[model samples]
Target: MGDVVRAPWDAYFVTGFDTCSEVLRGRNWLAPDFAWQERQDDPERWGAVATQEMTKTLSRLNAPEHTCQRRSLGNLFDRSTIQRLTPVIEEHSARLLDDLAEKLRWGEADFVSTVSEQLPISTIGSWLGVPAADHPHILEITHNQVYAQELLPTKSELATSAEATGHLRAYFTEMVRQRRAKPGNDILTGWIHHWDAREPDRETADEILYRLTMFVTIASLETTATLLSAMVGLLLGEPGRWAWLRENPGHIDAAVDEVLRYDPPIQINTRVAAEDTVLAGVPIAKDSMVHVLYGAANHDPRRTENPDAFDIERRGTHLTFGGGVHYCLGAALARLEARTLLIQLLERFPTLRVTTPPVYASRLVFRRVTSMGVSI
Candidate 1:
């Protein structure tokens, strides 16, 4: 068990599994609080506008609105929907792996660009009904927007992020308009129909649709890419681990779960105290910022034996997907992508090895592997 530690910024860090769970599940804790907003260097700048657009996402919305939006978009990612996506995931993974194998013949290749980054973006793009040719453009826009979260983004970087945000909003707005006129078998169309059936007001529905599109696109692209990069780097870090996975292909699911718990992409989630409350014997004033360290909670010894060990067979659940109402909506889709890709990779290159040390991005909130050189 861990004690609540106070930071110089007056924020509380909850690390223990039970304490973090209490904070995450407590109704008194609300997201999109002042903590995240405080990270903005200048609220008057263009970056602030881009940040505002992102804060309108499902992850940042409060109850009632959050509840309704989540319910509306829930069906699209239900178990059956994710299961149906297996073929699509496998197809993309196989195609990417083939390209990777061909490139590896030249000695080495950056797996992050060749496979890790492209797979998730392409898979999510297809689900969103984006034209295959536009997937790269969408990827570039989202990637730029994510840099706004860097600890200290330069003025130029923030301006670039703002420009990208503008482009994304416009593109999705037009796409939503088209999808409404001609519904498709894609998730975006499903979302529009769901919003129309419930929202009744066209303008409000459009706003909701735009924000939902941004939320899903960026979340799916960045998090899944980070996960794939980290998983590959970790598995290949120990040569024996790759061989073990290749031999036990059926363990892919467990392996993915272990990776999520071991080194989650999103390391910390923040919430504000909605009301004065006491957590784990600590008194928290109303509106206090509470930082739930998901990575620390996942590694809590009280929650799992040998918490630091990456054992696929380890039992119990992890806080990586979060818990309670705010649990990750795309959890199933992320797992499906990781599992399918890992299985296919092992089958194609059981002897794959990391040719150089993996490079982790210098960000406190997201565990992103910026580069991982590999060869077979």
Candidate 2:
């Protein structure tokens, strides 16, 4: 726990920023009402606006169901599996740099929409057997779909997102059909064959298609992009820090972690307590809302030395990537993507510097610097 933690809202069950060991308690730590998401409460109404295909599978899953789903999917992102994806990571990153070079040369570029957004889309598209030309469209659709829950309005946005969902489902359905006829080495191809072999009737090939693609694409895209923005954003503003990277490139990973700690890509996680429990000395009934504050906890001076300073040499755990059962499955992939992107940025623009203050996304949940003018 840090000195400046975002304590539980109840205020009576507990207080102060405490170590995760204290606040989280156990692997089964569920504050009151953690499972009660706002969207799920009005499924019928939101389904009219959200992707009908995803509501039951993703947004409505409770802890037990989520645990089971995560377990099966977790194996796909295991340390070994993720390590094997490095070549894919390297290839996508190199291509991203090449694309950026062509798109903007000796001119102003919006780093977020143009560059940061390309990474996970390319990687995920490649993994899913999606055609390269279709990645940008997929990213646009997925970006809206991911945020539809928190910030969305009017029927027009809903119609556009719904259309994307249909396109995606149709695309993956065709891809699965192709993989079934002629299986390949790709994950999409493998999963199709594997699921049919194991569960047969229960786990049909296309049953998990759309949601899985959403899980793969959007999860990797947003977090990785935000991390890249935060990491590069900080360095671009401080010439001395950029110079340090030019001198010692190996320190990039530490700086990436420091970025997550200093200004995390993700600021908070929404939780609903599974049952009645106490948090920070506050008592609560079942299903209370819980938020693990990443920003405040990362700045807690008790847990970190000079928590305010963005020092690459500093070492401590950060909750930018949630905790326990809800830990981001894509953490390793996001790290790899950010690291590779940083390397490419260094090689392409060693003297890169920010020409103006970065313009960030308005969303509070996801800390993304949407635009940063850079000069090479």
RMSD of each: 2.7, 4.1
Model 2 lDDT tens row, 1-376: 3222344443222212364434443533552222344425655435554544554453335567566556556466777777778888888778777766765676766777667787777777777777889877777666665544343335765666567676666766666777777877887766665566656574353676445655666667777887887777887766588777868987888878888888877665545555687654556456554555677777777778788787887767677776666566778778888888888898887777766677776665666666776656
- Candidate 1: residue pairs that collide: none
Best candidate, TM-score: 1
RMSD of 1: 2.7
TM-score for each candidate, following the candidate numbering? 0.92, 0.83
Query: Where in model 1 is the C-alpha error above 4 Å?
Result: 33-47, 148-160
Runs in model 2 lying further than 4 Å from the true structure: 1-63, 78-83, 102-104, 151-167, 202-205
Q: Report the lDDT tens digits of candidate 1 across residue range 224-248.
A: 9999998898888764988987887
